[model samples]
Target: MKPRVSILAALLLVSVCAKAQDVNVEVLQRDLDHPWSLAFLPDNKSILITLRDGELKRWTPGEGLSAPIIGVPKVWAKGQGGLLDVVLAPDFAQSRRVWLSFSEAGKDGKAGTAVGYGRLSEDTKRLENFTVVFRQSPKLSTGNHFGGRMVFDGKGYLYIALGENNQRPTAQDLDKHQGKLIRLTDQGAVPGDNPFVNQPGAKPEIWAYGIRNPQGMAMNPWSGALWLNEHGPRGGDEINIPERGKNYGWPIATWGVNYSGLAIPEAKGGKVAGTEQPIFYWQHSPAISGMAFYNADTFPQWKNKLFIGALKDKNVIAMTVNGDRVNEDGRLMTSHKQRIRDVRVGPDGYLYVLTDESDGQLLKVSPKR
Candidate 1:
C-alpha cells in the first residue's frame, strides 16, 4: 500500500512566535524495511540506501526504487546490530567507491561493527571489489548498542562512531573499541599522529572515548568541526563537538539517570573534572539518530541550522547553530508519528528523511507551492 503524503496548507512555524514558510511532506517511497542510511550520488538525483536487513537499494525520482543491489557483505542482523550506514567516497564521481558500516559476527555468537568499501557497478546492480577494511575489537555477545555512523571530514579522514555494546565501563577503556570514535585513512590505516598512537595498551585508531551510543555524526560545513549526538540512559541526550584527544564523559558524567530511575553511581551529578561537557543537552532524551547541517540556498531561513532525527520523539529537530553553541528552534513532522531514522540535505537543497517502521517511508520536505 502506498503511504499517504502530507502537504500542510498552513505555513509551518519555525519557532513559538516566529512563522516560517509553508512546506509539504511528500512520500517519495514506501514499504522500505528498516532503512538505515542514504547517500546522494554525484548526479544529485540518484540515491543509495542501506537497509538494516543487509540490503542496498537505489532510488531515483521517476525511476522508483531498484531491487536490492547485489554483492553486499554478510551482516549480523540481530537486535541493534545490522547493516547500518552508507556513504560515498569524497571522490565518488571518479572512484565509484562506496563505504559501508555494519555489524559483523564473531566467535561464540559475539558481534561488532565493521567497515568496508566497494566500487559501484556502472549498472548500479552490484558492488565490485568489496573489501573489509576495519572491525571493532573484542566482539561481545550482547545484541544492542552498535553505533555504525560514518563521516568523512574536510581533510578526507574517515570517522567511525561505535557503541559501548551495553557495557558502560568500556566507554572509558582505551583498550576496547566500544563507545569510542575512531579515525582512519580512507583505506582504514591508522594515522601515525593519532592521539593514542604512542599510548601503550590503547587502540591507535581511538580519536576520542567515553561515548555511550553515538547515532548521529556530521561535519559542520561552515566551521569544519565534527559534531555528534548520542542517546542517554533515561534523559540527557546530548550534542557534542568531538575534538581530537578529548574524552567525552559517558556513564561517568551524564545529565541522565539509570533506567531504574536511580542516580548514576560514578557520575558526580553529571559532571566530571577531566571530561568534556556537551554544548547542549536535553533532560528528556529524544533518542536522536541522524544529523545534517543546512548550508543551502533553497531555504534561506534555515541556512546554517542543524537538523537531527529523533527516534523516540518521532520528529525532526531544527537547531540554530552559532559558532560552537546550539539552540532548539522547533520540531517538524510531528504529525507523521513515525520514528525518524535518518535525515540528509539533498543536493537540490531539500530535506530528505527516513521513517523507521515495519513499513518505512522515504519522505521529502520541500517548500509548498
Candidate 2:
C-alpha cells in the first residue's frame, strides 16, 4: 500500500525551505565609472576601489565615496586596459602601504601591465612616495589582454598576472614577461630563488609560463596554495592551481579556437607534452574575473566555498571545492543583469561585489533576517 501526501503539507515544507535559503542584497553605492576592483581596509570600516578610467576612491559606511585619491600614475584607458586591481599590504595597519596595477603607456603609444605601491597619506587624499615596482617587458601595440591581477602569498612575496598582449605566440617565449605569472619580493626585487633564475634567456621573475589572460588569482586560506582563472580565445575558460616553473598551456594546447573560427592545430587534442592541464575548464567562456573564498563565519551555508565574478555571464558563481577539483554550485545577482567585475569576502564576514558599467555599483550580500 502507498501513502498519499496532502497539498497543504507540501506547501508548508516549501515555505520553510524558502525561508532557510533567503539571502539579502543591498546596493551600497552606485554610479561608479566602470569600477574594476575592491579591497577592504584593516579597520573594516572603509574600502578602496579602482576605476578603469584612472581614478581611485575610498568608501565608508558613514561618509560614502571619498574624493579621487591623487598620486596615481596616468593609465592608458584603452580597450580592456586601464587602472585594474588594488590590494592593501598584509601589514597595512602599521606600514600603510597599498599596491596597484594598471596599464602603463610606453613609448610609441604602446602599453603593458605594471605594478606599483605607495603609502597612504594620513589625510587619505593622496599616495606618498609612489613607485613603479615592475613593468611588463616588450610592450606591444594592442591594448587588450593586459592581465593585471595582484595577490600576495602571505610569505613576503607578491604575484602579478600578465597577458599575451593579443600575441598568442608570446606566451611560450620565456624571454618575455608577457603571458607569465611573475613573483617578486615585497620591495619589488626578483628573488634569487625564482624558478628560471639559473636558466638562460628566461626572465628571472617568471614563476610560471604560457598563461593567457589570467584575470583572477588568490591564495587559499586553508591550503596556502595559489589558484588562478584565465580567459581563452573563443571558449576554454580555465581554472588552474599553477606550481612553480610549470607551463600552463595556452595557445599551444587550449580547448578554445581562434576568434575567426579557425582550429588551433596544436590544441586539436587539447593536450601537449610538457604542458600542464587545467583542473577545470568551461567549454563556453563566461569571461571569469576576480574571485575569493568564503571563509567568514557569518554565512554558515557558504563556508569554505569559492566565489568568482563572471563578466559575460553577469553573475557571481559559487563553487564547491573538494581537494583539487571544483563543481559549480549556483549563481548570484542573475536577476540584476550586471557584469560582476570583482568579488571579495569583506572583513566583516559578508560578501562584497563590484559591478562593471558606466554606472557601476558596489553591492553587499548578507543573510536575511
Give the alpha carbon lDDT tens digit for every residue of 1-369 in model 2: 111212343234323321222458899999999999999877778999999999999999978999999998889999999999999988888889989999988898889999999999888899888899998998883678999999999999999999999888899999999999999998789999999999999999999988989988998888889999999888778888888999888778887787778886556446777888887676667789999988888878888788888899888877777777666656777777899989999988898999999999999987666
Q: Report the number of clashing residue pairs per model.
A: 0, 0
Clashing pairs for model 1 are none
Candidate 1 residues lying further than 4 Å off, grouped into runs, are: 1-22, 367-369
Per-residue CA lDDT of model 1 for 130-244, tens digit only, reads 9999999989737888999999996869999999998888889999999999999977799998999999999999999989999999999988899999998898777888889
- Candidate 2 off by > 4 Å: 1-22, 265-268, 367-369
| Residue pairs that clash (backbone atoms under 3 angstroms), model 2 | none
TM-score of 2: 0.92
